[model samples]
Target: MPAPYQPAGVSVGDVPGVAQTAPRPPLREDLNGLRGVAIALVVVFHVWMGRVSGGVDVFLVLTGFFFTASLIRTAQSGGSLNPFTRIGRVLRRLGPPLVLVLVGVAVATALLLPRTRWVDIANQVVSGVFFYANWELAWTSQDYLAADPSVSPLQHLWSVAVQFQFYLVAIVVVFGLAGVLRRSRGVHRASPPPHVYLVLFAGASLVSFVYAADGTSRLQSWNYYDTGARLWEILLGGAVAALFAARHPRPTHERRSSEFRTGRTALAVLGLAAVVACGFLLDGVNEFPGPWALFPVLATIALIAAGPDTSVGHLLRSRFGLWLGSIAFPLYLWHWPLLIFTLAYSGKPSADLATGAAIIAASVVLAMATVRLVEKPLQAPGGSIPRIAITATAAVLAAALVCGSAGWNFYIQRSVSDLQASDELDPFTYPGARELTDGATAPDADVVPALFSAPEDLPVTSVEGCIADFETRDAISCEYGDLSASRTIALAGSSHAEHWVTALDMLGRDRGFRVVTFLKMGCPLTLGTMPMLGESEYPDCLDWTQTVMSEVEQLGPDYVFTTSTRPREGGQGDYTPDFYVNVWNELTSYGIPILAMRDTPWLVKDGVVYRAIDCLADGGSAMSCGMPRGAALDPINPTLASSFRLPTVRPLDLTSALCDGPICPAVVGNVLVYRDEHHLTATYVRTLTSELGREIAASTGWW
Candidate 1:
């Protein structure tokens, strides 16, 4: 349908035949077909795994071979590779279709997505337009792909970026190397042999491949989208092209070279097997572009080396292959965003079988339609449009992508401003007050012991020097509730307990106990110092908590409440028992009665923060947004419950206050509970006061 890829060989009289032992064959349809198959495989794999297709490696090898051959042949014939002409050619090949897809995505995003999603989409649009999305995604991949909900539409550009980077370097280096060689005594010969360039490029590519194989940890850093890790793939193809060019014509019926001959069936089976293995055997989490990646890369090398006259190449170059290959670019571009949008709309993963199938079907149809209607018609010869007109059209599309993304971002921001101002928009209001009193209800998981060795029961630590007074970071003034208040209730722990002040203050008002709070964010009353959020240096939260513990010991509160251990470095954040046991033992030595509240559900849908409004906008009821009691807390942290049996450490659940049955309402008892994704709102804390007011009285044994 399109310009038919211009067929792949140098025309007659384009280059002189070197002193070759064999004739070079014509451009193989089988090889082009193989390219189509490779692109299809990539599309299918990405739709299913949200990962790269091993087939892309195959495409890279083919690109390398074609580009390298062209460069080497021109160099050997004493033709300088004009940089502007080369860049113009590449831009003509890749730029038009890419611009169309990007602008289309921008228009679609503006029409469909909500305000919360626009900021990220706008950032992606800018990076994608400039071809730097690889760096953006590489940073995002650090947390775990499984946790991420939505993948960017332009994520596939990482490879394109890598290829572009390689081409820029290769053009300069190849031309520069030719100049330097011509000046040397060894190179004054009229034409330098093409193998010299091929051998050197191949050698560099191989070295990089070997480096990638040996040190894969770097893949997550720079190697993932780096040209070095990928150079060998292109170099392998280039080597083949160089070999083909330095050949003689064979008499009509005879095969000219031993390397060009192959059993068609064997090549087909071998290539197919290699492709399947890459898809099934490789995992998403492993450092990609690492040693394990050689399976796909080398398999592609094998396929390309087999040649199109062979049975494998012939099959690949069939009508089916050609059609698919022709549409591959558009298909690859459209598939990811379609899948991403589907998953984002559903508020879940599309990894299941049914959804995956649907994604594949939709992607293929869209690719075919776009290729036939837009790409082929516009790019086709004799279309009657001038080159200037075509260039103007491209400019218009580029401008639309920029303006559309900006306009949508502005619209979403305006909506947020307007909504925040309206009294009727109370449904969207984050209940900061209610969240303050609901302390232990926030969901947090425990730190893994392999990353952090939590301390155990100390030998009857005395109260003498243990009690140390410290100034607070926030100016929370200590006021006398009542001079006659004999009973002191200490809230000594992390923000888990600090958030409960609204309820505690109410209890102090209704009951006779004085509420004293000694808490900091994320410290969680742990005995040892661990890495804190944001700050790279070891957080002083533990040191600050130690000071609070000492002062609480001197105050001698009747009841001391703390929370479960949350995430530390190296392990996922989930509640565990060892963390609670460590804290309980430290406070128990001071002869203070302890009350441990189970943490609430940390609502992270698809590794991204989800607000109640996100769910409501998507047609999900407010209750569907919250995690159930059984889902959030695990009876008690497993490590603590298994080893220690403390009578004072009572497990208190206000789950009924947050959820009913398995349905945890985003708004609890008509009050919004959480302010941010995990933490409770200050306003929500006041509402919990009535519910916990009586519970504390009963639990403290001070009725």
Candidate 2:
């Protein structure tokens, strides 16, 4: 968990802003208690509801508030800001528990996770150690093929990265502004005027807010992890702190007035209520860092402004709250990985209520132990900056070593797999798709080479710029098979439709028909806009579909092949979506026949998608890893129903070749069936060449 801002205390007495002549305010135990409450909400919401709590937003505000106040106070007291000293303090507070947790998670992953997942976990460990997990996730989110039910244990570290980034930015801004003020005045005043800081905060917040709001609407997945989009929440806290500093404290007589007390009490109560309500009322994961984040941020600001002696404040400062707050950082660090590992081990996407409670209980115990045994000793008083720097450097080196070893091992495994694939093994034992439909027994699934290919082993057509990604709009044409052949077959659609190109390319070479591909990563040939993972409209896909349709029409291919059916939500079997129907109707009007291939079974079970390599590496045999035929597919092809009404549309389904009587095996004829959750592997598809060619010849009468 990202650490909450430490309240002002004797530890920071040397900072420039404190007035040596006047007694400083006592450390705010109530704010610490607030941090405890925030962590509680975060853990419970994550474990039981699988949603984000607005707790992180509150912490971001508190972090900005305390950090800004310290800097402003230092500037006011005529002390120059020391970036190294400040950053060292922050590292001492955050680094120990984070490193401990990373090492612990790495050990846990090695013990519990499958071999196939080791590389990903290692990558995450390195990224988290270096404070770049958010950037890594942003890149991963853009890949449509990377979606999986298995959650990374280090996913929570994205917030930690954001917090560290803010710390760096805040330090630079404070020092830079103070230097400018000194130069302009020619006389060193303690600090710049409060109004100057206020103006700067306002401008920064407005820009960040607008960027966040607009980006959320356009690309929420990218925005979710974006540091720029989240700056306003922290900046708002700085603005509040500036306002508080500008006003001198009231006289004792005025401060003790009954009216003042009543107003403060009332405001504190309302603010506390709002803070608690946010956790329950809003879906923080979906609504946040955007304008919707105001709920939690404002509630926190209200609580801070209400001061410490009110009823709500007293409750927050109670023994339980203070204790929770004390351990909040370590608790946050331990809980997420524990929860994710528990779910993975249990083979459940979400834990039941009892299991969730147990997980929370376990996390609390581990967090307490971690703080007492690891964090406290490292952050003990009199620790030198040089010592801390050495420790941090050592930790980074250790993480890099682990990551490097994992990458080397992964490369070796892939190299071996590639080498085996390139060699000609006995065709009888490694009999591709022939064993599935031709009564040949598949070799034992355990001993098969190339049983599971890495993501890089996808078809050349799928990887080599032939398949346009989400951001690409223009159609990229790639020719395969017999380029000189007079007859041409156009393959156009998403990766699902593109997977069959391996088989079609082989057929073209033998049958003298040129194969032209117009492939996009995840976009099907549809007139309607495709909805992306974050519920944002895929305008690029829509625009690209129009472009491809025109290109295909102009090429005037003998036959255009594309997927024609999609699985109905919360229903059995597949159906032709209206978008597919619209495209087919238009294509047939041009008198060019449409080859509507039935889409393959997606290996999703009980809402959790299973990856073939993960299943195989987790000791699952072909029979154990395969999905039930009835669960994955309808008994009859659904596209046949829609195609019968259209004269130029021909439905070609090869489900029998992919599935046996009751099971759709992950490995058919000793060849891995899927590259990921939904797309077929090139190796398996290539084996379907003979059957696919025969079907096309019969339908088009061109061979």
Candidate 3:
């Protein structure tokens, strides 16, 4: 990404009108070839396979290799150590393509995405332009519930951000060392030997490796997007670069014997095979940046070492390889947005082979066009962007993106806040679920959570440390609703159960019962092993469930209000898992009566999961965006077939209040039923207060 390896002005023995610059290392054809292959893998796998290829790691290594070598050469020459000149050159090389892509993403987002996603994409743009995309992604991706069709199209810039940050740090460190040497050695020898940098980078790599290994073991989801966890891969490349700089390599390989050439070729072939197989052989998303990442890292190093002697050498120097290398940086920037837009346009979860191929073809065409229109002219010697102009343009683009994104982000956040505050100003105007349970009538009115605010219409536990996130083992609890009342009712389980708090709060306050919550995101209140969160084993969830059960036991609430069952995954009808039954049985043994509520129907159509807010934005009616009852629940309750028949386990189902006839609508009585997919919105849950109160009273005889 560092200026796409700009051709040096006036190489040795070439007659040129340009002034000669400091000597640089000969272009490694093998490295260029490897870059081409890596980019192809990145695109093909992402579009067609739905799997991660370690191509980004390959780029990180190459960035470290090329940048470190260049830094050392500059330092050794006692060159002007001003960092701005160098950074400006890099901007001139990288700025145009980056600005064009950001503009493209902005246009696509405005045209295709729902209002619910506008704030999210704008925040992403602001983060992306300022070169902190990795950190932004880590923060936004923390919630399991938030991962949905709303994935940011600008997400691929995380690698560019990491590399840019490294450039800044690497420049300071290398130049600082050079300055110290100049003072000590009287400016004649301004830099240490290459071995000194080799050792320093090696030490940094080891430290980064330890951090990465520990982080991956602890929480791969967060670590995957962490720059600290990914630094070693790039630093290791710097170590290799320094080692090679110390032992200068020949530009030509003909001086070596035929036997040596054959051996080198064999090693290069083996290394290339490893790079090609790395993604398929290992689960990169779950296991990478850990020790397993060594596979692709070492393979890239091998290609760099092998030089240009084999068929790999010829292929790399070929016209196709050069073309691929020329467009690699822009191609990486272009492919991801194209893929996401394709999915949105088709309204499908993923692209089929034909569709994926078409996307790839489109990406290549766009990449070639970008290289011709945006990259080449600016990077050419006599182009408009002399160093200062490039730097200024980059600053302007970054400011414009930040300003535009902030405008949209502020507008959406304020709008959501206002909607939340006024959602209950007049209950009669938005009667919500009361229209079903109490025959309450009201004039037609707008939904409680307006389309733009729906994504923020979450229950109280979604924030403020009220519930444990997916990563923790701590059983965080909060007291809500009639805290001073003698009788206590515990709300326990995942967000589904946590969402009932709004209604339970009203019931508890009016009926004189305290409501205590035992909640965790995505963790159901069950004795069985919780489902794996993403790809890694969820041992944290396992430990968390036990901690929550113990807390519930100690509280000894009059009745434990919790979700009773889930809609069976990948099949028809709902059923209670044995783990759920075991938890119910154990609570009964503790003399705690159980008020088990059936879960709501998921908003799915055919095989694709759809968000109701997205449907509403696309002009679908409330009932049209809803799910059919038979698709999620049986005609008779599925809980009856389970252990809920036990006297201590009283099943509570209010599907009647949530549904009308056979359909479960996204909005009920002018209130949005769900904030996301299945979790009931706090506003809608509040509307169900009267109906839920009756159920709790009958179950506990508290009334």
**Top candidate (TM-score):** 3
Model 2 per-residue lDDT tens digits across residues 1-703: 6433332211222334334433445677788888788878888888887777788888888777777777776666666677887777676666667777887888888888887777667777877877788887777773211112387888888888887887788778776688777788875654577777777876898899999988766567777788889889888888887888777889999889999999989988988888788868876666677888999988888899889989999999998888888778788888999888888888888888998899899999988897666555554445666456646664775666566757756775776567446634466776777886677776565443443335545676865778887678899999998999999989999988889988888888888999999998778988864745345556677888899999988999988999988776676667778888889888887778899999888887777777777888898977778878788777788787777888788889888888877988888777777767777876677778878877887888877
Task: After superposing candidate 2 on the true structure, give the runs of residues whose Cα lies further than 4 Å from its correct spot.
Answer: 1-26, 142-149, 180-191, 247-263, 383-397, 400-426, 441-453, 473-477, 484-486, 529-539
Q: Of the pair 1 and 3, which is ahead by lDDT? A: 3
> Which parts of model 1 are misplaced by more than 4 Å?
1-25, 48-53, 78-80, 142-149, 179-196, 210-215, 218-232, 235-268, 284-287, 343-348, 351-362, 377-387, 406-600, 604-613, 617-622, 636-703
Report, for every candidate in turn, its global Cα lDDT versus the true structure: 0.57, 0.77, 0.78
> How far is each candidate from the true structure, as Cα RMSD in Å?
11.4, 4.1, 4.0
In model 3, residue pairs whose N, Cα or C atoms come closer than 3 Å (at least 3 residues apart or on different chains), thus clashing, are none
- Residues 1-703 of candidate 1 have per-residue lDDT tens digits of 4223532111111222233222324665665666677777776776676555577777777776666665665555556546666555555445566676777676666666554455666766666665666666554442224323445556676666666656666567666666667767454323457667667777887798787654354233345555666666766666666666655545644454444364534656687688766767776335556667767767766676565666666667778877776776677777777776677656676457788788888888877776665555444443456544555676677677778778766765565444334322132233322333343342332211100010110101111122112213331214223335778777666556666765676667677667666655445666654533332222355566666677777888887866654532233344554545776777789888677665656665544555553454445554677755555545545435623577666555565566555655655534455644566654455556666765565666667
Backbone atom clashes (below 3 Å) for every candidate: 39, 5, 0
Candidate 3: residue 619 lDDT (0-100): 81
Off by over 4 Å in 3: 1-23, 142-150, 184-188, 248-255, 381-397, 423-425, 526-530, 644-646
Candidate 2 achieves a global lDDT of 0.77
Candidate 3: RMSD to truth: 4.0
TM-score of 2: 0.89
Rank by lDDT, descending?
3, 2, 1
Worst 10 residues of 3 by lDDT: 7-16
- TM-score to true structure, per model: 0.64, 0.89, 0.91
